[model samples]
Target chain A: MLNVGKIEEGFVLDHIKAGKSLSIYHHLQLDKLDCTVAIIKNARSSKMERKDIIKVECDVNMLNLDILGFIDHTITVNVIKDGKIVEKKQLSLPKEIKNVIRCKNPRCITSIEQGLPHIFVLTDPQKEVYRCKYCEEKCRQRW
Target chain B: MRHLMSPLDFTTRELEQLFDLANDMEQHRERYAHICEGKKLATCFYEPSTRTRLSFEAAMLNLGGQVLGFSDASSSSAAKGESVSDTIRVISCYADICAMRHPKEGAPMVAAGRSSIPVINAGDGGHQHPTQTLTDLLTIRSLKGRLSDLTIGLCGDLKFGRTVHSLIHALVRYENIRFLFISPEELRMPSYMTEMLREKGIAYEEVIRLEDCIDSLDLLYMTRVQRERFFNEEDYVRLKDFYLLDKEKLSLAKDDMLILHPLPRVNEISVEVDDDPRAVYFRQAQYGVYIRMALICTLLGLTGEEGGNIC
Candidate 1:
């Protein structure tokens, strides 16, 4: 059992896609953090065959909605008071988000030479297709 | 209002409004310059759709708006395994609206449900291409003055042509628009579209021969027999010849008859038809910009001169 030092405070991201710890770490920019952080990849998961885990020991206030939408996983944020979980929080889909991930359409206006921000709107929940406001293209697969 | 994911969703009036606005934008592009100023429009294309994507950027730019987002998926956080919902939720914060294209069916609809701002469906898989339908409508209106009472022959891969599928659905709104469906037996238009035509009381007929109805058609819409649809080499080679629209074949047609194609064409139509003065595919591509311009203005609620640029 690898000892992931107990956090006096902060969060524990659970059920990450296997081999995605480093990606998540880079996404969150954990290396630039002012708090102690620990990551474990290829960890056994009850819900998943294998998972990755990350523990952040700081009062970071940010929403990782991109992760929630990118993969099928769970994240748990806990506020620690004297080594006990004072508050436990799970990641939920945000109604809206900003500048987290890039659109995958190569011919999309965002892919042009101009300084345009690539965007998509969630239309269908069951299929997860996004519509481009400019092109009116509908795509179900996430890029 | 959340998204234009399908032509099925737009009412006749709403679709016409898009056309009307497109007409105005085409005649006077500079008039709508400030419609999207200070607002961000995001283009999220999951596939390689250069023509479709650039049309959107042109629409936004002509509207005096700024655009952003990624053309390639690998460059985005999605490669690192980001969820679609999370991605849009984040993008919604930065942009006032979005355009998306995906290789999978119904992906944009997923983003729209989670998004607060407007979502526009660019194209998805081999499914709906509503914007292309809009372009067709604008072209017909400009060239023929109306969408009704015309004999339109749809030639090529009916089963796999997304534009053809969408065009047929759109034509249902017009009165007395007869259809001469031309395609190989294996590539026949889907039964659902036929059922839809029947339910809507639109008249149509399917024929394997394009020349049989060439002289009778007021418009001939051509598409490539998508080679990707055939499993065997023998089937593709056999069916490929059955749909070619050459100028010699056009000589048997009416001079007033207009020919159209949702371009990026293969060998379906002979290049000789380009000088026939009836080929309207290139003009059709330009209308794409006009139609999209009108759509952006309407969707963004920039109807007023101030919103669309007064000075």
Candidate 2:
């Protein structure tokens, strides 16, 4: 059995779909931060058959929960302080996300414009649909 | 500060006010002759749309404003790889207001975000052409005497007809507007549009032939159905004539029914039908100029008493 140490501060992202820990790690830009991160892939779970987990050692306020929520709201965010669970954070869909995903529509202005920010606006929260701000093309969630 | 990115950018009440201004401008052109005398309009058409560009230029010129800018991207700074944002910021310094038409969807929107002057989306790929919608609205209101409680038939290439979709959306905001969609099976209005109508409980019907529903229409909006939109030549050949509007088809329509086409038309509307009193497509083009004049005045905050306080 592989064991990981508890973080003194920061987030313990739990119940991420298996194999998605690496994606979450890169999306959260944890690698760019000057802190330790432990990634546990395919961890056995009672709720999910197998899931990925990420433990970050940094300030709790450093992480952008909106990106986390937009990526996978089903994942649990456990905030830790002094190596103790402080708060269980909940994730909700963001109204707008910028530069996270590129508009795939070839006819979209963002495709040809240099240095244009790829913006997606949440049009349908019930169906979790995000449309490109420029072309109104629905984002096909790949991840 | 306000830019027209979509037809819905203006509410129904605002549209009514705008139509009133357009009607007034149409009635008394001399009053609005020199309202924009000192203002300059920059027409930055990245794609060549001679009809739209000319109409905008005519509107500004009619209002006594100067017109300038390149008609195509090749002649403009865009050929030098200038971004829409950068170009609009520079045009802001030159013109009091700007009209932009680009081949790519949402290019005007990108420009609007960075522009110091108001940006009118002349047309953006197949995404939107708000001024066209405004023109349609103004024409229906002026000729029909009202915009509501009427049966409108939209014919040809509904699947890809951005104007049809925009018109449908704009009209639904009015009360008791029924739609008759006429097109071949392959080019029927998309399910999303029909679904929207259904959700709103607005009445609509889908038909394959224009002749079948001509007499029942109060207004008929026609668009060309290109052969390339069909899957095979056989289907295109079989279905092409059914959608064509000829004198025979016009005979079946009501005497007062208005026929409107966003022009530069092909065989979808027979040239023989042009002389028919019911065919108002030419008059619709005239209305385009009037509506654009109203739009420029409104956007520049020049629509006050006697053409408002012009800066």
Candidate 3:
């Protein structure tokens, strides 16, 4: 069995759908952070059969997990401290997300307006539907 | 400051107050004439909707306010690649309130986000036209004496009719309102709309022919059926006549039944029907002015007798 060392601080993202860790990594903007990070792809899991895990060694406050819940709330977020799991953080859909996704509707004002932030607002929590703030066009869930 | 982006932006009670103010304005136009005397209205039209632009201009003029701004994107700073946000910020300094019409959906919303003064969405591409919806409500209320407990038959191009969709969204707030959607199968109301009505527990029936439910409707709203909407020319030719509202079709409706169409219509409604007392689309345009006047007053906080307090 291959083994990876645990981080004394920061987060351990677990049970991400297999191969989606890179997307989460980019979405969380981990590449922009100066920290030690490890991405485990297609890890065997009894719960999910195949999963991905990402461990980051940095201050807990450095990570912005707002987009995590929107990406996939099923993925578990564990806060690590002193080489042990400190707390499991819960994730919920955000009311609004900015520049996360672009509105694809050609008639949308964002298509022509300069420097307008592409914003998606969560209209239906149960259905997991996000619509563009400008045009109210439903965002196609790519994730 | 508040901006009118959608009809649902205002609650049922607020709409009632606005309608009441409109009714008061209709009854006593002279009393509210100079309410906005020193105020200036900037009409920023990114598209050429002469009817809507004129209605807005007339509404401002009726309110004793000055009117300014561009009628087309080419004439405005937008021609020089100026953003809606920047144009509205500049307009905010020049006018106390602004009404905008854009070919792009939600352009006014972008402007409203950055605007210092109140903004009213005149019409945005195929999106919400709140003032038009307000005018329909006011016209229905004025002529029929009520907004609820009526069967409204919306005919013609239901799929792409922004007015029809907006009217449905606005009318669903009233009690005992039933919808009769009349359209060709090719241009039927979108599933999302029917699903919304179903979810809200509102009663609605979709029929292919206008005559199937014409007699039962208390109000019939008509929209143009475009030739481009169909997959082929044959279907457009075959279904075009079915949607046209003529005197013969008007005979099928109740004597007191009101007919409405968002104006600048192209042959969907016969010019012969214009003389019919039941055909109130022209009067509906007049109500457009009153509703807009009331809206400008409400948004500019001129609803109070002293003109400083909001309603």
DockQ, all candidates in order: 0.02, 0.84, 0.88
Maximum-DockQ candidate: 3
Please compute the TM-score of chain B alone for each predicted structure, in the order given. 0.93, 0.95, 0.94
DockQ of 1: 0.02
Best by lDDT: 2
Kindly give the stretch of ten consecutive residues in candidate 2 chain A with the minimal lDDT sum: A134-143
Alpha-carbon TM-score of each model against the true structure:
0.66, 0.94, 0.95
> Best candidate per TM-score, number?
3
Which is superior by lDDT, 1 or 3?
3
Q: Sorted on DockQ, highest at the top, how do the candidates line up? A: 3, 2, 1
Q: All candidates' lDDT scores?
A: 0.77, 0.91, 0.90
List model 1 lDDT by residue over B1-311, tens digit each: 54788876778888777787788778877777876788888998877789989989988888888899888788776777665667789999999889988765556766787788888888876766778888898899888999889999998888878889889878877888999898878889989679778878888999988778898999999987766666788988887767677878999998888888877877888888888889889999999998887777777777644444445
Give the clash count for model 3.
0
| Clashing residue pairs found in predicted model 2 | none
| Superposed Cα deviation of residue B193, candidate 1 (Å) | 1.9
Cα lDDT over the full model 3: 0.90
